[model samples]
Target: MPSPPYPVNADGCHPDKGWTQRQAAAWLVQEESPTGEVGFVRSTAGFNGPLCEPLTVQVQFWRLTYRSAAGAQARGSTGSAPDYSFTMAAMKHVQLRVDGRRDVVVTPPKGYYSSHPSPCVGGLVAFYTGGPLTEKELPSRIVSGDSLLTFDSADFHTNRVIDSKLSSPSDPAVCDADGKPTRPTSAPSFPAGALLPTPSYPPIRLNPTHT
Candidate 1:
């Protein structure tokens, strides 16, 4: 499995926070892939269980342009909102990839929302606010494990955003582990919005086909 783009710190910083251009280049060459696809896979158990009731799946992709000491481009899911924003800062632009389509720059407010910079790092971030399942939507029970829940780029933006907010920023922050930002105790709240009709659940089975 591919690791998320963020670091593992609470605030998303690390020891090697500021890498020299040569270091960044070397790291990029060894650590990051230039192009890739990411998405969530519903677990067979979740689909069979009650937790799947309100959940929906979505996949997102962004064109990453890295700047600083070294510059490069890559394609992959932003993981979650904060992760999207964190990933965005290193890149010049982003294109939303959903349902097998490419080069879809999501229109903000309708498709997503750019949010306040995290207190730890002043990086710009964004999340999906629209959809049948807004951030407010909650599951009846909590599921766990690689088998219980899979989150990549393709799940509802709300889920992506919430997951990012809940995730350790250190997991994605460009800085090294010692220099990553401190994690936020309280997650940022979602803006007010109407709840769109929930997407219907796809066939519940082990390894259901994805677009």
Candidate 2:
């Protein structure tokens, strides 16, 4: 199965937890396609009994295919231009509204906020980039955006911000009594207003899906 974009458990825990092909085969029924391709089969599938339920499931599919565990992703080099290259830029000073006060993280001029930046900020944000193209610096640029979404610090911090915002137990408006998100009244969102929720324990360290 394809990896989830969001967390699965109430604790912002992922049921898969970086399960490998062999490990996944232990929990799920593995099958070979007519073309000799290995995949998870829905019918007579293998899964842990009383499988942990998902807090939110987005875009369910009947079958999920993969070229390999991790598909091919191109990586570019530094200087001398190739067919494809990735330009690198460092973040200079940034301006934000902290608790309704205008706060700017400016250095002598174009310098990065080397300290830990706050997760929450509001109002105008000026992302000054592009200074001088050095091994570090680049030209000056600005990116402006309003609060796209908000999360409780606890919820936002859960699983490095990949946690679930909605309670795992079904919401009647979103699901039938059976616990399905048939018509969700409100989807999981970063806690918008005041409340900030934190995870109870330190989250587990997950391995990279690809070797």
Candidate 3:
């Protein structure tokens, strides 16, 4: 099984330790979804690099706590239970290279833990690229035909097929026509129009090694 970047607590809970600015930035990149489009108003305020860049990362652990009795029992509770939870780990910063793009060399960070991820680890790593526009913004692309690799691990290798991809906001201007102030619409929450497609590529495996 794969190991976590830092040892988890005895209760299998990830420590709530704070992360460095770079670490947090790396995590944000890893955490963003690989599908859909972000229409305009962007977050991830401080990062200024292109949407996609090589990532140096480590494994992170997460816990899912059941908030209701139905939720607890659905996971196979033996008896009536007020609450329940489960824990698992996932590797982040798994890099995906696009077709025809030049290769990138990403040095692994300290506390490197390389292994085939545990089967229990869930979700696809985020593949970042410039959103609909070229401004500094979060990744808004999907993994549709690229090769996913693991640079954080000691031995770099490749995973051939990405079985699945994991599957969010904004504001408006105050200007009006003819230099007249416009009134806000009474129904602020309406269905949005058809959206343009974000960049997409193929995927790879669970435990990535550099090829």
Candidate 4:
């Protein structure tokens, strides 16, 4: 985890409380799906170098809650009922790497307990190149692997492999255009395009004659 040069602000946090930005960033972990796409999770995420550098990040789903801990603890802890006053929103806040670090930040409403996220669910969140720093999108919710990415820069101490390199899933299977769960929540998009593969089909055995 890299030190985010800024504060990790939340409802119950104080100016004096919280870990060093590096420590907090470390608390954010990633669980790579069997396919090799990276899912980043930390209270606060940061990016270095220039904003002009092209980069695309996909946020599958997230929760924002004000709970009593240095970071979000998702297991063995049950959160209270949803309260709108204490907003636990999934936001992708970006600014120029050197110029306007403090220009953008969202302050959640006061009077909340800790980081227990909302029960509500939303679609994939993303920040694309050339878009406004404060603006983001939920282009598609389905997860796929149409490309392969490798981290070859010397800035990295060790080589890294990103198996399924996807810019953004062009078709959404779980979410809608606005990041909301679509109606008939269990149904798949019609026409059955390659981008939207059906999951319920029976498995096929290849090379059955080999034996």
The top-ranked prediction according to TM-score is 1
lDDT of candidate 4 over 1-211, digit per residue (tens): 7665443344222232333434323333344442222343322323321121112322222222111222212222343211111112332333222111122222211211122211222112222222332212221122122224322111111111111222222222334323343434442322212112123322111110110
Tens digits of per-residue lDDT, candidate 3, 1-211, equal: 6654434344433332353434434333222222321111122322222223333222211111111112222122333212211121222233333211232333222212123211111122222322221111212221111113311111112221111232101011121222111345332321222111112411221221111
User: Residue 165 error for model 4, in Å?
Assistant: 15
- Predictions in order: lDDT: 0.25, 0.22, 0.23, 0.24
TM-score for each candidate, following the candidate numbering: 0.19, 0.14, 0.17, 0.19
Candidate 3 differs from the real structure by a C-alpha RMSD in angstroms, to one decimal, of 21.4
Q: Residue 15 of candidate 4: its Cα lDDT?
A: 32
Off by over 4 Å in 1: 1-35, 45-54, 69-211
Model 2: per-residue lDDT, tens digit, 28-59?
33332222122333321122322343111111
Candidate 2's displacement at residue 113, Å, is 55
- Candidate 2 residue 153 C-alpha distance from true site, Å: 51
Candidate 4 scores a C-alpha RMSD against the true structure in Å of 19.2
Instruction: Predict model 2's lDDT versus the native.
Output: 0.22
Off by over 4 Å in 4: 1-93, 98-114, 122-127, 133-137, 142-211
Better of 2 and 4 by TM-score: 4
Q: How well does model 1 score by local distance difference test?
A: 0.25
TM-score, candidate number 2:
0.14
